[model samples]
Target: MARVQFENIYKRFGKVEVVHDVSFDIKDKEFMVLVGPSGCGKSTCLRMVAGLEEPSEGQIYIGDRMVNGVDPKDRDIAMVFQNYALYPHMTVFDNMAFGLKLRHFPKAQIQKRVEEAAATLGLENLLKRKPKELSGGQRQRVALGRAIVREAQVFLMDEPLSNLDAKLRVETRANIIKLHQSIQTTTIYVTHDQVEAMTMGDRIAVLNGGVIQQLGTPQELYDRPSNMFVAGFIGTPGMNFFPGAKVVAEGDTTKIVLDGMGQVEVPADYAKIARDAAGKELTFGIRPSHLEDAALVGEDSQRSSIDGTVDVVENLGNELQVYLTAGGKNIIATLDSRSRVVAGNKVKLYVENDRMHLFDTATGEAFF
Candidate 1:
């Protein structure tokens, strides 16, 4: 029941800077996710918060107190790691109570806390079992249970589900979400997976090259990305980018000369913004799902449509990905998973104006 704050955090290892002026506020009980690619400094940022690595500059606050010089244990936060880090010789119960034992908590109090955490995590039956006898998911649960017994104000997790199998990862992900809802601890989960961030975070902070690209709700980031990098990174199949220029007219009409979809009228709300970039070189972005099959083009009269050859096909359960080349550019369309489309076939796809994103070709800044 505490808020975590990073104020202008900066981390550097010698001459190479890892995190650059990163700052964010995690409200009490908020499940904030830190996400990016492998070298994006997400883990370094998390480590700074956990007191494992001090920031080169800036202050970290836990609740109302500045904790920049505080030790990890005194910060009143519990951490779960990618590895279970369980003691092989100790039973699950002992493993969970180890922290309390080291802190000199009374035996009776430690037992009660351990039992409660194990029960909450469905680890009651595995209490007598050692880490070796437990499955990967079970071992992970023990690790989480160890943290839960401490009842810290904040929970810090670093890819806690990465070690599980695909099915188990999904299950564990759901479990973690449910656990957070029940306990309502302020959680800061760090991971390189955008899917996990989208599914788990109340708000996701997108990072790149040690800088935050965007910080907003999942829908906000997906619908209105601040820049080109975020627009291409958030979605499943991601947004398709192409070279184009805005088309403006005398009567407030706006459009783009897309090589594949042709010139389609921009949505009325977007006309003013779109008109600002007329005749200028820019990048056009559209989500794969934003494009629709020509035959089922709904009431979206502002959409641009064109015919193209499907270069490749990816059949997923609920959707099919059609790779197409248009206007000398390669683009992907994610249509109904049931759509019976294959590679090298001609098909019609449409991209509505409102769903389109425009970015300056030179600066990569969003034009609309």
Candidate 2:
């Protein structure tokens, strides 16, 4: 395993720049995920590391060796693509051994590596099966096994699970995580799915518009996102955003006023950061999970309450997602699955003040 680093990496296509001074370090044996929406330059960044695409400017290093001018085959990296790029006619064993055979490895060594990879990937029983005969999940395992047998310094996976069914995707995700744990290979994964990024990576770099927006652990990005974009992108249901919000100091307390909705009372300690921003438009953010039905909350709970007309309710097995309009802005609340709330019902929701996020209206930067 080896650490990977990008030093002020920049990539351009003719006159249009796609990657702009992107830089980050992936420690030895660490799993790093590059995640963002489509056309966000995540795949381009990964290609650069794999030596498939050279950076227009800046340097990339695998271990301590600069690899900007190196060929992909010389980069000591193995890539697993989204399509599971397996050979149709070749058996699983041959597919995994193909790389080693091409490198002119001894027959015994190639067989040993292929068998070991098949065992590690739980494809031992399917070694004789062709790609067409195997299930999607099995085929993906073969793809992984092919990479594993290479014993490369780094493993790069680009949306390797996107083709699987939802249930199979979850299972494969766990399988990949287990595989990483046992082998502890340095991995750089690229995906548009935030859920995949959150669960798979030891550290995630959230990218957008060809730039790294934030890089942190899953919980760090979820709990303390650097800005409005990070806040809105990292969560499952996404945070509810209310623009044109005003904060007013009221003696020992502060009132966060939402036009046409109502004001939430916050203690001095929580509102101190907004003291000087009174009357200035600010963006208010609250995660759906932080909002709960007022009736479910204890009377002494410190949460402030707001009333809204429930517009929609979604019942997942363990929780209910309720969408409502409060203060003239649409918002979502996650509540107990036992909640009886339904569309058209007028309900009071309680917000956890300390858990709320405040951002600048114009720049979208977080205030606290």
Candidate 3:
């Protein structure tokens, strides 16, 4: 079926555990991303599947076979690395055909495969160019063509776009998505960039401190993260955190007590849970996009508002990223460009009541 699976996987280097009991499955033709900060053991996990590193415990399966003891060459998988790794002296066509040449494939067959991959990656016109003559994006496509010509059951790409310029990264990212749709190859991609993980992956496994924090579709991770780590790490600018928040019941309504800021009344549907969590030290999380200029919100009683002093305002043409401090906690809010809020002024930011996230302070797990 060309599905990749990891069962109770563990990796240790010199008695220091790195990957701990990690397990996940990449379905056939699925694009699964392994993402986290550097030194999170994500590359180590990919290396295990590629047979470059043996796991300290448990098993790894490619398609249905346990490949723990198999040599990398025999694993029936193709890998594209972070670096282009193209031979400076070789032409794009030659680089793409190198692996086939090593296997002694028929000359006509090698040419056919290389030509097909080159066409797929839009490198057909640049096949005769050497690595030094090509741009970073073209070299990367040559690397992709090399992997494509193999037609392996799975494609393993490790930060393949990291070396490209920002504009090229965006263009190449779209190209990779289109290529995946065309080939329908099972892909396991690794990157430290969450934006890449969010946009490119069919599903993402977020790793941190050598362990997986959460695994799900992009929307699931964004809208309902399992814990504080996932909530903070998955978004740009991360999520705003208000630590030491408390939930309290006041007569018919339940409210979240933000130390210096006034209490936020809980919605009727969430009142019961808020009451149950009352008196505990909790963390409140809200995305920058969820907070808006209170003036733009008029006087909606359904939404709550908090007052803060503007610390900074970053104008990005289409929107304003306002940094403010409320209740002694720093917060960032994405507001409309039309808002007149500026630095060093008192601002009231309206909160999207339904978008708020509550997390357990001690364990970092999300309550809702």
Best by TM-score: 3
Off by over 4 Å in 2: 266-270, 300-303
Report, for every candidate in turn, its global Cα lDDT versus the true structure: 0.87, 0.90, 0.91
Expressed as tens digits, the lDDT of each residue in 1-368 for candidate 2 is 89999999999999999999999999999999999999999989999999889999999999999999999999999999998788898999999999999999999999899999888999999999989999999999999999999999999999999999999999999999999999999999999999999999999999999999999999999989988988999988999988988887767778777777655666556677887766567988889998888787887233377778999998888999999988777889999886788799898888787787888888888876
Which RMSD does model 2 reach against the true structure? 1.6
What is the alpha-carbon lDDT for the whole of candidate 2? 0.90
Could you arrange the candidates by TM-score from highest to lowest?
3, 2, 1
lDDT of 1 by residue, 204-234 (tens): 9999999999999999999999898888889
Minimal lDDT window, size 10, model 2: 298-307
Per-prediction backbone clash count: 2, 1, 0
Backbone clash total, candidate 1: 2
Structural similarity to truth (TM-score) of each candidate: 0.95, 0.96, 0.97
Best by lDDT: 3
